[model samples]
Structure formats: C-alpha cells, structure tokens
Target: MTVRVRLFAGAAEAIGQDEVTLADVTTLGDLVARLVADFGSGVAPVLDRCSFLVDGVRAADAETRVTGTVDVLPPFAGG
Candidate 1:
C-alpha cells in the first residue's frame, strides 16, 4: 500500500520537501530504509533523531505499520 510521509524542521529541509508519497511499505522501518536509500546522508542523520506519528498516534515502535500518514518530527521543530 501507499503511505504518506511528512517531514518536519530539519528533516523537511534536508529532503527539500515536507511530504512524500511512498509505495510498497508496510512498516515505519521499511519507510526509514527507503528514505535512507533514496535520500542518503541528506535524510539519514535526520532519521536518527526523528520521532514519528502514524495516523496521529505516537509511533514508538519501528514496526508500526504505515497505513496512513506518518509524520516525522524532530525535537523543537515547527515552531
């Protein structure tokens, strides 16, 4: 299924966009891996410190499935 990935603050700046539509991802982990492969260093470092909200609930686990929007938030972001 397709998932919407939203980036905040430094993460968004690094990727040069706030949101991306990704396909063939089932878990947050899968999304991370894809981001790293697609964006490389530009996004990898940001991912290291990023926290996530999947469908509006905090995604504390990497295995959280991406059935809807996944917001990638960094600390002190989006002021």
Candidate 2:
C-alpha cells in the first residue's frame, strides 16, 4: 500500500519536508520505521513526541493500519 504523509512542526523540520509519499507502509509502525530508515536519526525523536491522524482519525497505536493521508503532529503550544 501507499501512504501520503503530512508532517508538522518538529516532524517536518526533522524530515526536511512537510509532505512525503511512502510505499509498502501497511501500519503506523511500518511508517515510522521507514521514516527512520530513510531520513536517519533526526526524525526518531520528533516522531516519538508526535501524534498521528490517519485519514483524519486519531491512530490509537503504532500497530494501527494506515492508508490515504497520515498527519504527523508534534506537541503544540498555545495560550
């Protein structure tokens, strides 16, 4: 399967881009592995602090199956 990823905040900075298209990423865990493998160490920490929305639905766990668009959102601060 192919998944389109949208990165925000630190995730985008770490990966050096806000959007990416990945193949064979069947689950959230698989997507993380692929990002770490493709982008190296910089992305891991950012990913760790992030939450994911798969097709606008919150992903409950790394094992959550992913398709369509996956949004990577780092912790946001506002007042």
Candidate 3:
C-alpha cells in the first residue's frame, strides 16, 4: 500500500519538499529506510534524531504499523 509522509524542519529541507508518497512500506522502519536510501547522507543525521506520528498520534516504535498519512518530525532546537 501507499502512504503519505509529511516532512518537517531540516528533514523537509533535505528532501526538498514537505510531503512525499511512499509505496509498499510495511512498517514505519521500512519507510524510513527507503527515505534514507532516496535522499542519501544528506538526510542521515536528521533521520537519526527523528520521531514519527501516524495520523496525529506519536508512534512508539519503528516497527509500528502505519497507513494513510504520517509525519516525520526531526528534532527541533530552542532555548
């Protein structure tokens, strides 16, 4: 199945877009692997510090099952 991913912060800049469509991703981890492969090292650091949400709720694990729309949120820095 296909899923919609929304990228944020540095992750968005690395991928050059705010959203993307991923196909045949069985788990959240799989989707992340694909994204790393697609964007290469440019996105690696951010991916390492990222968190995920399915729909609107935080995903607890990379193995979490996902569908429809998800958000990939990279760590944000502030005081």
Candidate 4:
C-alpha cells in the first residue's frame, strides 16, 4: 500500500518537500518509524510538533491505519 504524507511548515522544511510517498504502510506508526529511520534526527523534532490528519480527519492514534493521504500539519501552518 502506498501512503501519501503531506508535510507543512517546519516539517516540510525539514524534509524539503511538501509531500512524500511511503510504501507498504499498515499503520500510522509504521510510517512514523520509517520516516525516523529515513530522515534520521532531522525530521524527529518537526514531527513531534505536528499532528497527523488521515484523509482530512484528525488522527488520534498512531496505530491508525493508513487508508489515504496523511497530512502532517504543523501548529498554525494554515495561517
């Protein structure tokens, strides 16, 4: 399964992209682990300050399954 992660604000700056695609993701935790592994410490802090949105809905669980685009929204990035 391909999961799309949309990064905003500092998260996007850390990754240097607005979006990223991950493969074979079963849960949101899986994606986070993969990201930590892939980006090392660079992305950790950014991720910590952000929240996850799964298909436009707020994600409350790290164990939430990835069904569509996962938006990584930083605090007040909408502004």
Name the candidate that leads on TM-score. Answer: 2
Residues 1-79 of candidate 4 have per-residue lDDT tens digits of 9998989888889888898999998888898888888878778888887899999998888889887799998888335
**lDDT per residue (tens digit) for residues 1-79 in model 1:** 9999999988898888899999999999999999988888668888888889999999978898888899999878355
Better of 2 and 3 by lDDT: 2
lDDT of model 3 at position 71: 95
lDDT of each: 0.89, 0.96, 0.89, 0.87
Candidate that beats the other on TM-score, 3 or 4, i.e. the better one: 3
* lDDT, residue 72, candidate 3: 90
Instruction: Evaluate residue 17 in candidate 2 and report its C-alpha lDDT on the 0 to 100 scale.
Output: 97
Error of 3 at 18 (Å): 0.8
The ten-residue window of minimal lDDT in model 4 covers 70-79
Q: State residue 19's C-alpha deviation in candidate 3, in Å.
A: 0.6
> Total backbone clashes of model 3?
0
Worst 10 residues of 3 by lDDT: 39-48
Per-residue lDDT tens digits of candidate 2, residues 3-76? 99999988999999999999999999999999999999778988999999999999999999999999999999
